[model samples]
Target: MVDRRLFDIARWSLMVAVWLLPVLYVFGLMRLLHLENAYHTCTQARFGVPDDRGLPVFGRLDSDVLPPRSVCTWVDGYTLDRVPWFVTPTMFVCLVVAAAASPVVISARRRGVMAGTARRPW
Candidate 1:
């Protein structure tokens, strides 16, 4: 049982590492984009804006203290890539699904419950 638990944990850990690392990284990148203002500007430029920047011209909600046309700029390329719309939230949803599935899979496997008819292995 303990071995099974360890195996389950290890398997899930590898699954998470393989499936989630890039997505999580991308999610983090998206957050950075919003925080650093690079994502906003890129989105703005895509919509045809005059500023040589990435996001829309309107400053973020918190930055309302700045001037109306206050253009936010980031100093690093790490902040330059705009997270595609809805990608971060989607990644979060996937993470949630993965987390929820891990325990269910572990429990089911530990019980040796197979959902479908098995074809005998030679």
Candidate 2:
């Protein structure tokens, strides 16, 4: 029993968000890559070149998409440094927003179709 106008607005907003999700993901990926590059550069400068064994003194650069992290890890599998807290949370929030909105939008569309009230053609 939702107001028609409000429901339409919400639906449109969710649709818009769905379209924007890729853009959000791309930006998040770019940010993570930038962070990883910076970390590698800094670590290389701080720790000098690789050892006689041809292994990096600063370990490896690693990243994750979900919950988004860019990290420098030590040889012993310990994190040396990570991107700021805000970076990961920003991507996480984007993921959560997409997760929360997609189901509602899909259900509303399905309901509309079931009721023979879908206006726009898919």
Candidate 3:
């Protein structure tokens, strides 16, 4: 059998990890968008008219002048291109579900003799 302290620690670790997942997802999405923005602006300045708004994705020219692959820390043309629009919405749903479920889970776990210990604020 698992030690009770180790079990509690593992449980707390999992809870914290699940709670942070949505935050990480949001940061990732923002970074991906920022990379796209950087590459877009870079390409616009490189080949297209300055301050142009009609440029295609990643500021690719309507003609053959495509933006070169970005080497910046956040820029990964291949990965950026594959990031789906559904990711943000999916994360939103997961975050909401986790938030809603936490209280219910805490209440459920508090039904034992340790109820007093679980009375602290979530």
lDDT of 2 by residue, 2-75 (tens): 44564566566566656666665666566466433554554654466423255544556677876556677766
Cα shift from native, residue 46, model 1 (Å): 4.5
Q: Give the alpha carbon lDDT tens digit for every residue of 12-37 in model 3.
A: 65476587666656554443443335
Q: Against the true structure, whose lDDT is highest?
A: 2
Q: Which stretches of candidate 1 lie over 4 Å from their true place?
A: 1-21, 27-81, 114-122
Pairs in steric clash, model 2: none
Enumerate residue pairs that collide in model 1: 40-55, 41-54, 41-55, 42-54, 42-55
> Mind sharing the TM-score for model 3?
0.35
Clashes of each: 5, 0, 0
lDDT of 3 at 4: 42
| lDDT of each residue in 8-122, candidate 1, tens digit only | 6555664774587476655555444333344445445445553555433443322221111223334342222233445556565656766766766666566554333333467
The lDDT-based order of candidates, best leading, equals 2, 1, 3
TM-score per prediction, in order, is 0.37, 0.45, 0.35
